[model samples]
Each structure stands twice: as structure tokens, then as C-alpha cells.
Target: MPRRSRKPARPTACPCGTGLPYAECCGPFHTGAAKAPTAEALMRSRYSAFAVGDESYLLRTWHPGTRPERLGLGDDRRWTGLEILEVTGGSPLHTTGTVRFRADYADAEGPGSQAERSAFERIGPDWYYTDARHFTP
Candidate 1:
């Protein structure tokens, strides 16, 4: 009898459901191997960053033109999960775009959530997260 090869592990589906896998989808970008094409990609990578606690990646993707002097990653707000509400106003590979998302998490007090309609700008072949408004829920 001939020996059979083992099956390979499947990559997780991208939260955005762009018909791509998480590993090949946003994983490389989240791990600093690739660049995002649109604002939505940056946003997705940031979500992945939070999921994996990659603080440095978060800072790198932040738009330097509008990035804050201090990104307090140590702020004690534990993230529980992420829910992408909607994605609109961008192409398959956008040069400029926007992403609206709802992120759910837990803290020292209790469960909480933040909804945001974030914008982005592409600068010098790089996509940067420009603006975000946190909504009260």
C-alpha cells in the first residue's frame, strides 16, 4: 500500500469576507509583512492587531500625518471580540476609503462596546488610518 500525505490546515476566513483567508487575507499585514490596499484593510488589520495584542503593528498603521504623539497601548482595556458592522465607499483595491465598525470588549467594570465610522488616506503607496469617531451605545 502507498502512504498518503496529511491534509494542510485551513486558514481562517477574513472578518471582512473579501473571499480571502485570514492568514493570506490580513495576517501578513497584521504581522508587518505586507501593506494594506485600502482604509478598510488597515482597519481590518488593526482589528486583527487587537485580537493578537500587536501594539506595535497598530502604531505603524496609524497615519503619521495625523498620528497622535502618544498611543497609550497599556491602558488596561481588555478586548473581548470584534464585530464588523458594515463596509462601504471603497473599491476592491481602493486608493482612498472608509470603514465603519463595531468592536466589543470587556473591562475592569463590565462589558462594553464602541462603534466607529473611520476614514483613511493613502500616502506614498501606503494606506493610513486617518480619522475615527467613537460612538456611545
Candidate 2:
């Protein structure tokens, strides 16, 4: 029997709910091909990274001042959705901003959601996630 070569799977829609393909959406940011231009975009990319378990992207995009020494994303949890509720500042001309969102997920315990107001800071042309105030809903 002859061996058949398999092609790579195509990228799917972004997990951030942007209705766009992953390559045109968060893939660039994940690959360092581009930087997120706004706070909301950074937030979306961050959520997408979580969905795909890209720890390096998450750590690299996190602000050094507040970034933890390490991050542990267990394989047991599956991120299901992202909803952006609010955005402030984070413009092409602004250096600071915030994004409020709800990221839903499922684990052994069942389904749950995490709502947060995350702060971001821009250095030169790049946006970095600073910290977040988590909330219960």
C-alpha cells in the first residue's frame, strides 16, 4: 500500500467572535506578524490565545509590571466564547485603555464565565495587557 500525505487543516473563524477567519484576525498577532492596534483588538487576541492555549503569546502581550512569573493553563478547561462589553481610551493616539469582557468556558465542574475589566498600556506602537479586575456574574 502507498502512503498518502495529509495536508494541514485550515484555520477556522476567530474564537473572539469577530466573524472573521483566524488568519485575518488573531493569527497575525499570535505569530508576531502584527501588533494589535487597539485595546479591544488586544483583548480579542488574548481571548483567542486562551482558546488555543498559546501561553507564549499571552505572556509576551502581558505588561511586565503586572505579568506573573509564570502562567498555568490546564488542559481540562475549554474556552467557549468571548463577549466585549465596553472599551475606553485605547485609540491610535492614546497610550492607555481598558476593555471589559466576559469569557465563558467549561470544565469538569461544568460551565462558568469570567467577567473582567482589563487595563492596557501602549509602549511606542505595541499594546500590552496590564491587569484585570475580575467580577462575578
Candidate 3:
């Protein structure tokens, strides 16, 4: 897909490491227009959560117990890009899924980057991030 500029008319054009637009990208997933079918979709939604400060979405997608009671929105690093490295099958009803990704952004610390390998689980058609190894996710 062609890279989208963060233009206003295109709310989904956020190069926020989402790998897709706010509209066709995580927007649909966030607004209940769709459900993530794989670990890759979950990871992209997580990236979108960070982009728009939709901590609620993040929390909602997180598995219970590990789910935070609250999420404080604050200044955020400007996101640049998302590079999906890999994805693995979880299961039919519920399975263990894995995804690897690389993200770029700018922060007070300076231009920075994150590479993560994340895990997900599908429970009754809902996909949630189970754990994020500091190594990448």
C-alpha cells in the first residue's frame, strides 16, 4: 500500500506506526467495523491506540488481569512507520499467536525506535494481546 500523509481529510493517514490508515486501518477495528483475524491486526490496533491516545481501546484489547485499571494520556512521540516482521497462528476458537514488528517515532529523548515480538489470544472471536515481551512488543 502507498504511504499516507497525515493529512486532515484522511484521519487514517497517521504514520503512527499503524501500517494502515485510521479509516481502513485500526479505525474499523476500533469502531467495531471489524474484528482482528490475526496477531498482526491486533498489533496494528495497538499501534493505533498509541497514536490517538485511545487507551480505552488498548485496555479493551488487553487480556483481563494484566489489564491496567487506568491509562493516563499525555504527550506522545510522533510516530513514523511500522514494519511487520512476522506472524504465527494461534488457533481456531482460541489460540496462541505471535507477531514481530518495528516502530519509529520521535520523543524528547530524541529520535527513537522500538522492535517488539508480541503475543495474542483469540477467545470466542475476540483477539487480545496476552503479553508483550520487552524484547519487542
The candidate maximizing lDDT is 2
Ranking by lDDT: 2, 3, 1
Compose the digit string of candidate 3's lDDT tens values, residues 83-102: 88877775454477888778
Query: Model-by-model lDDT, in order?
Result: 0.70, 0.90, 0.74
State the lDDT at 101 in candidate 3: 79
Candidate 2 lDDT score at position 50: 86
RMSD in Å for model 3: 6.4
Preferred candidate (TM-score higher): 2 or 3: 2
Residue 70's lDDT in candidate 2: 73
Clashing residue pairs, backbone N/CA/C < 3 A, model 3: 12-22, 90-95, 115-136, 116-136, 116-137, 117-136, 117-137
- Angstrom error of the Cα, residue 102, model 2: value is 0.5
Q: Cα deviation in Å at residue 61, candidate 1?
A: 1.0
| Cα error of candidate 1 at position 129, Å | 0.3
Candidate 2, position 41, lDDT: 96
lDDT of 1 by residue, 1-137 (tens): 99743322324875444567778887889767888876777787787666555667778888888877756554356555566676765554566677777877777878888889888777777888878888754
Candidate 1, poorest ten consecutive residues by summed lDDT: 3-12
Between candidates 1 and 3, the one scoring higher on lDDT is: 3
